[model samples]
Target: MTDTLIQTLDVALGERSYDIVIGPGLLGSLSQHIETVSPTARIAIITDETVYELHGQAIEQALAGRQTHIIIRPAGEAQKSLANLEDILDSLFRAGFDRSDLLIAFGGGVIGDLAGFAASIYKRGMPFIQVPTTLLSQVDSSVGGKTAINNQFGKNLIGAFYQPQKVVTDTDLLKTLPARQLKAGYAEVLKYGLLGDPAFFDALEAGLGQDILDLDEAALTKAIHVSCATKAKIVAQDEREGGVRALLNLGHTFGHALELEAGYDGDLLHGEAVSVGMEMAFRFAVEQGLCPVADADRVSAHLAATDMPRISDMTHLLHDPAALLKHMGQDKKNESGHLTLILPRKIGETFIEKRADREAVLRFLTQLRDEA
Candidate 1:
């Protein structure tokens, strides 16, 4: 249980395999991960306003001797937009970023997602490192190379599975994060347990206490390392979300819909959405006879213990179930005119299912508002 630091490796396909560094004091060691694969022209650190305040200069200072520019956008999920991309590109150009310039994501999932997307498309793909500061990003978003932005359609609608050169997980940075954000980020951490490994969930449940107000370096590092390894295996087999990787989306289908309805406001953090989404997915599966009601309840209890949102509160985001369903239909994961659902067959086990009937989904939505 006293895992202060650990070195783990994940093999991503296409000549892009890399190691994940997890431990305390990682923020200070970020420079080690920034690869000079080729001659680099410049460096750009893209993060949101909030993250920059926390470790912007620390990261920039890590690359201090190099040519670096920092792009700090206003904090919010809505910031992930074509407009923001354009602004970031402008900043990169102003900072003299060329074909070989590097981009490092120094925030939670949103910033990591945005920075990765920017790196992938800029000048026909540039180098980028994931310096994920939040537990959610460290464990989930920053590891997989899945970069994206949102739109009128839904969350992460526009994105690519572009892998990062290195994932720098500094658990130290998490200590300064607000408790609410910390709890919200743990949703994704718990996700690895929900989808693939039940043991990790048990560890998280036992380790995460009400007084987790301060970061326990050992606990945080273990969670991040395990989740990253899980993602690495899934990504290795199916880097483009072909099959096994879809398992990672256990709560995302339902979660993304809620985030869009909330307009990516600070009100619904990504981890919060996923936590509730995972619960809803399980509960909906139980409703459809795909799983037991007890399974759904257990999922709810785990999320609640971590201070995550509840699926029963879906109605709070909106009044009409049809509207939410409509949003779900627009999800990128949907296929062949039928929405896909990642449902849990039981607690600690989930899978992607396409058998969810439309009426059943709508009926559930009609009741979501009441729960909200």
Candidate 2:
């Protein structure tokens, strides 16, 4: 018999109430959640090539006992594009999906964002569930109901505020994730700590490792629970990226710009960019005297231990520090011609700011030159 543990998080929206189910072998329970929201109807499960190869058949078999549509795309951030979104729509159309039919985002953050964005626009809106298969998606992207897609303008520039019917995260699926992906996801997991809750940071610092990667059931569940709960609390306060919701973009502005600079062709994953971005945010904070130098060093060391990128590496990516500032100025999180950069006062403590000067920003990026 397969063991399972399910967690139900109430996002606090009365009519739009959702649940986050976490378990050891919860994928098999996908049908149960579907039934909770849907009354034995047709559905489509959208995923990527990587996930499909690892989990497609099992998911299909579990749900094949009923009407189902399984849509697959090439795996990676590149697949979260208009072309793939179009293909997913075509597949849904071919499957005769209607307003009543459901769309299931059945992979990592990329698949969840793409599939959720498609669901948001299909016939205006439809109820879909976030079956996140990655640590990043489960903790941050999947639960917040902020569905978006990247365009030439920027990452997640074009999207919606559509919430999922539910989110089912299976820890068992994570067992197969590559180490790089695991660490990338770990970066987001650590964000919850770096964002709030110092003890969580201590826990991650103590136990997140290679041995823990394959499957430390206790650690994995706690990580998912805390990350989702953090997002859930923030989303409850600001579901539309208005107030504290912007805090969630802690490392994203620089992160997205780096992805665009690299052309988003899987050369650098989203989490990789954010890993470096967080490092930059801290460095910028220290250089601007916004926080203590020791705090900034601590942030970089923790990130390095996780094998994430750093500020010096970023200076190499963009030769012109002015250009990076320009890219950051264009971030969606910005307000009133000011950048909403989330800087760390110390690990386990971060807050959004609109007071840092542009010249100081240059000083920070320039500081990396000396380190490199």
Candidate 3:
């Protein structure tokens, strides 16, 4: 709660710009922040059951007397569905909420995406705030304004780019996160480094990575700030993802295919799949002679040293290269019926290959399966 500890970064979107406030115990002063954005507007909070069970009372206390409506749903990646979206819309409509009111996405990425997407379309765009609780949500999803829900075809195919009015990131909440979930989120933290900053990657390789996994307050804070700052900068330059913003999805194409194969059943988390996908990207790059084997080996080594999920960890789906390739073909990044992959040139650098050879990718997948 120390004023000196709190840091705020801005996502510069001209008039739609918003602040991402990071620190511990910021939730204690949530009401004041809410007042600044939507003082007279009614508040509707959408969160998952798990998060509500842990922090429900604190949230109620934070918003003490603000005409609040609490909507809780069962927690899981599976919950990010069209059915849940409809249910949320019905609840908002039944509650008589209007476009001028404020909607708060009060959980991890699932709730944030669902609620933010709901807010974006409801009554032609109601204002919303992001109060992301998970490490993945805090560093990545919450700041980007790329709200979405999953579908049968792929993950996050149905959604919108609707920025939140404010993002309240309380690092303290991560204390209650299960270790597995925390590690899953760390995959995203690692991603910021892998995709762009070599210095950040070097720091992670040194000891900052373990410090973050250990939940060291200083390390966690710094990583979150850097990740958000990186994402915010990209989003500003390419608000609609016409250019640089796609860099943010370095491993998502392959990762989403893995998620699709897993059926959004909570068995394979987005970040976990992303960890494997990043490794695949590097290996794929090496196979294509675009990057050095040393770079790919280093990426694999770092992921293994951190105890992250790897391609080997997903042997169950490895047998079907055709299926995985089919999923990849449907990736949102694909254009003109061609596969688009984000491949690494080296550590701390990546490029979007728009016309990824379908057969080459299949051969690579077959090789992974054979090796597994």
The TM-score values for the models, in the order shown, are 0.93, 0.94, 0.99
- Indicate the residue-level lDDT of 85 in model 1: 83
RMSD of 1: 2.3
Candidate achieving the largest TM-score: 3
Q: Which pairs clash (backbone N, Cα, C closer than 3 Å) in model 2?
A: none
lDDT of 1 by residue, 238-328 (tens): 8887777788988887888888788776888888888888887887787788888876777777666655778755557767677788888
Error of 2 at 20 (Å): 0.1
> Where is the poorest 10-residue window by lDDT in model 1?
205-214
Candidate 3 stretches greater than 4 Å from native: none
TM-score-superior candidate, 1 or 2: 2
- Rank list by TM-score: 3, 2, 1
Candidate with more favorable, higher lDDT: 1 or 3: 3
| Rank order (by lDDT, best first) | 3, 2, 1
lDDT of 2: 0.79
RMSD of every candidate to native, in Å, equals 2.3, 1.9, 0.8
